[model samples]
Target: MVEPVADQVLRAIDQVRERYYRLIVIVGPAGSGKTSALQAVSALTSAPMINVNLELSRRLLNLTERQRAIHLPRILGDIVQETAAELVLLDNIELLFDVHLHVDPLRLLQRLARNRTVVATWNGTVGPNGLTYAVPGHPEYRRYPTGDLVIVEAKP
Candidate 1:
């Protein structure tokens, strides 16, 4: 039987466990099966998988720029603790692409990965330019660094 590509990605993730490269960003176009990959991996893993929906996270709390920078990690940390999960799958991360939000999500996720492995779905394509969160000229146009990030491209 042929293993699905997500299994391959999961194997890579598992291989990197306990290593310095703990955070992975799966970048792909819409409907490219990134979320499905995460779900499948979550189901088969021994460690609990905490799926953090950025949309719900945004609605559940309101914070100032300073407060968000300080508290977002704490809030996510609480969930990780409650779920007893060493691996976290972040979905709907495009919500953070809103330009009005002052928090740098890449930095925040990077910080969180220091404590636990994070695999997030990015709603864009990764290329030579980097991880383009938004098209150029858009208010949210920002290319976060790909350095130290284990990038996986999800196939449809």
Candidate 2:
């Protein structure tokens, strides 16, 4: 039988405890139950769950485009720090891929995971090329090698 996504994520979190960046990406297309799986994991572990888009948007509401690009990294760091949880679950991370943000989404996640475990929902797919967000030619499209990051596929 297939393992549950939440269970897989929990296992991945435990597995990456010794890594420099404790990040486990749950990759799947929209409506693929990524959020549900995150919610499940949060409930199971009593970890805090964050809706990235909602939280980041609220924090960036007053910043100009240039200021946003300059301050985004620090702002994101503050957000994660505010959670005060050793393990943080993040969903709706589409904002990090915004071209205007001038951020490398995957790298940003890795940075956040450096201090604590991060299990985030990625609206994308994984394949031979690596992890992908959106299609090529799309403004938000991004791809990255898996590297040391652990991935849990959220199959529909």
The lDDT leader among the candidates is 2
At residue 62, candidate 2 shows an lDDT of 99
Clashing pairs in 2: none
TM-score, prediction 1: 0.80
Residue 156, candidate 1: alpha-carbon lDDT: 68
Candidate 2 residue-wise lDDT, 2-47, digit = tens? 9989899988998999999999999999888899999999999999
Top-TM-score candidate index: 2
TM-score, every prediction: 0.80, 0.98
Off by over 4 Å in 2: none
RMSD of each: 2.9, 0.8
After superposition of all CA atoms, the RMSD between model 2 and the true structure is: 0.8
**Candidate 1 local lDDT, 78-120, one digit each (tens):** 7655765777777777655655556677876777677678788
lDDT of each: 0.72, 0.93
C-alpha displacement of 49 in model 2, angstroms?
0.2
